[model samples]
Target chain A: MSSTEKHIVLAENLTVGYTPKVVSEKIDFQLNQGDLCAIVGVNGVGKSTLLRTLAGLQPKLSGSIQINDSNLESYASSKLAKELSVVLTEQPASKNLTVQELIALGRQPYTNWIGTLNEEDKKQVQESLTSFLLEDLQYSRCHELSDGQLQRVLIARAMAQNTPLILLDEPTTHLDLYHKVQILKLLQELAHRKQKTIMFTTHEIDLAIQLCDKILILDGAENPFGAPCELIEQKHFERLFPAEMVLFDAKTGSFKVNK
Target chain B: MGNLKPYRFSFILIFLVLGLAWLLNISLGSVAIPFKATFSILFGGQVDIESWNYIIWNYRIPKAFTAVLVGGGLSLSGLLMQTLFRNPLAGPFVLGISSGASLGAALLLMGASLITGFASFSFLNDFSLALAASIGSFLVLLVVMIVANRVKDTMALLIIGLMFGSITAAIVSVLAYFSSAENLQRFIFWSFGSVGNLSTQQVILLSIIVCVGVLLSIISIKRLNAFLLGENYAQSLGVSLKKSRLIIIIATGLLAGGITAFAGPIAFIGLAVPHLTRQIFDTMEHRILIPSVFLYGAILMLLCDTIAQLPNSANVLPINAITSLVGAPVVIWLLVRKRKMLF
Candidate 1:
């Protein structure tokens, strides 16, 4: 709780699941303020599920999730929403909402019952638009934006919420290489400069290892949470994918297929 | 400056249209009263007491009020359903609530005499049918909510809703088969949909129900806006998905069920008005969308009612028939245009 010891999220023996089915069990972890974390795993390895559980989007199976010392379950949804924001992969189906209007949705928890945006909310929305370099497309409809632009718009919305902890599910899923690096770099910069904790799931293990301060690697059998260098020294990357299909090139610190 | 100016203009335009529609509704029924006389009678000025009483109290006032209530209620329900499911096709009819009400009304009409003879209950003969229809709509709403909760995909939920509607329609068809000729005629007339069926007392009751529903919707606007992103997103935003969905289902049931109980399955106002409101407003912000839809719905229903009551026509057209005539083409256009744009 000290100024330097900014604890953003804490999970103790956390188990995440849908009803009657446990995805992962007995997980204990802590995410501090200014931590850029990546969750990497094979397909169907519960990376998304774990992130959702931390964000309070999905119910926890057992144990507790604490955000900033208060139990996650005890925090009122609106109060929790103010402290934590989430960006999902699903594109909203609504057609007419503009980029600014879409990003303004982040202020919904703060807005009154009538859903009107106040001046402060509008200022935050503007800051988000500017920070994400989306000024030109501010008035453009969401349907008209490219997938990459839409992803940025969604990120901008989460940013606008000004939450200490931001959870994203595959932020770079549909982006090109340039935008992918740009997004990861932006997230890293956010952690460093804005002092926000960002946890995102990604398939780009190399980029995450290179940019993230901490990594939670889920190998389906054993999940490890620690610094990237520690995980790398432990040779965790070598076992991440199938042995025959792909191999981790330790010298380049990237994944290369043997075929 | 100009962009904000147009929104103000659109607001003015909507109000103007609503006012004009109100005037048209009060002045142009089967018993044509002069607009001036209607206004004078409404404003407490003394006139021909009998005609004034008949026009102001009996015919025009109740009909106008019914049009407003039914139009506003159905459209608001449609807006909420569309937002809740995140499907453009979601509406009261899609969820099968209307057909459930129809089936309930059909059962009452077909079995009223038999029940009256056996039970000797006077109020049962009068209010039992509406009560049954409301309960039926409420049950269908519950089922639809359960199905929606089970499904993750919005499009899949829409299909499930459609299937529910078809199931209710099938039940209604079975009930129709067993009904006597006289009851069949009465049920068929009810199914055709009409605002004129509401008496003053019924209009007052319907207004109370619709007001409650609209008030609930207004209170939940912030939650509804959160839901636009999807249920998970809404939950992460601190909305209790289960509670929000329950409130929405109840609101939808009350509005749809109450309207269907008296007006008999009025269609298209809910679906079409929201689309039109969103287009005119050029924003998905529900603060504007909700009120815009209310006004647009009232006007649209008023226009439909006027068209149904053609001056030279021997028989009034059914309200549902008129609304579908107006509504179907718009939906078809939405589908066709969406396809072309996507392709």
Candidate 2:
């Protein structure tokens, strides 16, 4: 790659797990600006652990993670907040917050001491509201929103953070197929249009293959990192599951039930 | 992100109501001072009766100020607790601060007589009572802070607080069983709760402690707002969880522990005032909430004190009874009518 295409996240020989037990190790990946990436693996394969480590929510077992040309450990929390943001799988503690207020929380790092939103902060919040199609529901309490709408609101909150990189743990988990695709496509548009590097963990491998610019498949060993077609061409998806249960159809880029 | 202009009118109205309630509270004591006389006395003007002037300055004014501080401090701590734990049911005393105070006062009132045979300490003043309660609450607060540091989960901390409450209550019960009748009576009266009988120095001390607590809460406005997203998200937003939690707990200790120390464990106001303020404000922002809850709490305390005085009657009801009698219904009615608690 050229120097102009900056690497937003660079992880080398990364190991992630709780202390005294290793969940996933030897993971290496680099995401450039404007890349929409996905981490796809079977359940209990430490996909969320990997994302959590990358987001600095937990300590990595070993290896170096760099964000925006600085070591992840080097940046102060407030400074790091401007470089990356995250969308969690768990619901917010208080759903009594309005959609607008929740999204405005994204500007916390830039807000004044008492969290008064300046003109720029308000502008970013408005832009995020517009992007996520949440304008009509800005005043609506989060508890009143549907699952899909709440998911959109969450992603909007991360977008309003205006970081160079975004990491989400299982952004498509509870949604139906259409809504999953809608969220992934929205994330794709956000990445490309805003030149933000986005990464998320999901079991929606088939959808991720169709929507993402890059895919990191964690298969417990020799985790592969490449384009979707390259991953499919190498038959990585074929070995993802037991052949007796399901099979990968590389022709149409999907999984088939072995009936 | 919108302007606060919309809530400005409500804030002004609430301030006026607080003033009215303060006037009403001062005027309706056993002496039956007129509202006009009370108002004139407040603004440094003279009342016709010399004794009435003495009553207004020396007694009712201090009592009303104590009520304001007790109510405002406890309610602010309650708001802090609710937000910090992310639980609607959390109150200032939820962490066993008042229970500790009770245990402290119980030991001083009953246990002392049980050991010394009631003659040596027959004349127990408010000073000794306040001092004992403050020590007890401070000890409990210290233990809670130590436990809070070790425990990672907020819910677990809440459970630990309740455990502390239970432990202290059992000790108080044991002490109450062994005491003499006179000592037991004093203890019971202390538990009934009061905002009166404080000297000028004590009120000033309570005011200083409450001011420190309020200042801490004000400083924590940003972190509290970020916390509405929960801990993980709040951390990602650059809030230091340990630091914020410590500041909030210390603020709660000062407000709940200190007020319970001075006011003899006044109940219900700390738990209900935040919810009541939320009924009208309709927002979760702490910048609006801290001041709003304080005003509402002060107003409620004044009104409750007025009713407890019984207006021209010498026999005063327990302020604790009046608070529950007046407050529980209003909260229930508001929740029933609104169909949801804002928290």
Chain B TM-score in each of the candidates: 0.89, 0.90
lDDT of each: 0.81, 0.89
Docking quality tier of model 2: medium
Q: Residues A1-259, candidate 2: write the lDDT tens digits.
A: 5778999999999999999699999999999999999999899889999998888888999999999989998888888889999999989988989999999999999998999889999999999999999999999999999999999999999999999999999998889988999999999999999999999999988899999999999999999999999999999999999999999999999999988
- Residue pairs in collision within model 1: none
Model 1 chain B lowest lDDT segment of ten:
B117-126
DockQ of each: 0.54, 0.75
Tens-place lDDT per residue, model 1, B87-165, is 7877888777887787677667765645454433464443566787898788878877787777777677767667767
Cα lDDT of model 2 by residue, B53-168, tens digit: 89989999999999999999999988998888777767756777788899888888888777876635645777787778878887887786687557856677778778878987
Strongest candidate by TM-score: 2
Q: Each model's TM-score, in the order given?
A: 0.93, 0.95
C-alpha positional error of residue A21 in candidate 1 after TM-score superposition, expressed in Å: 3.6
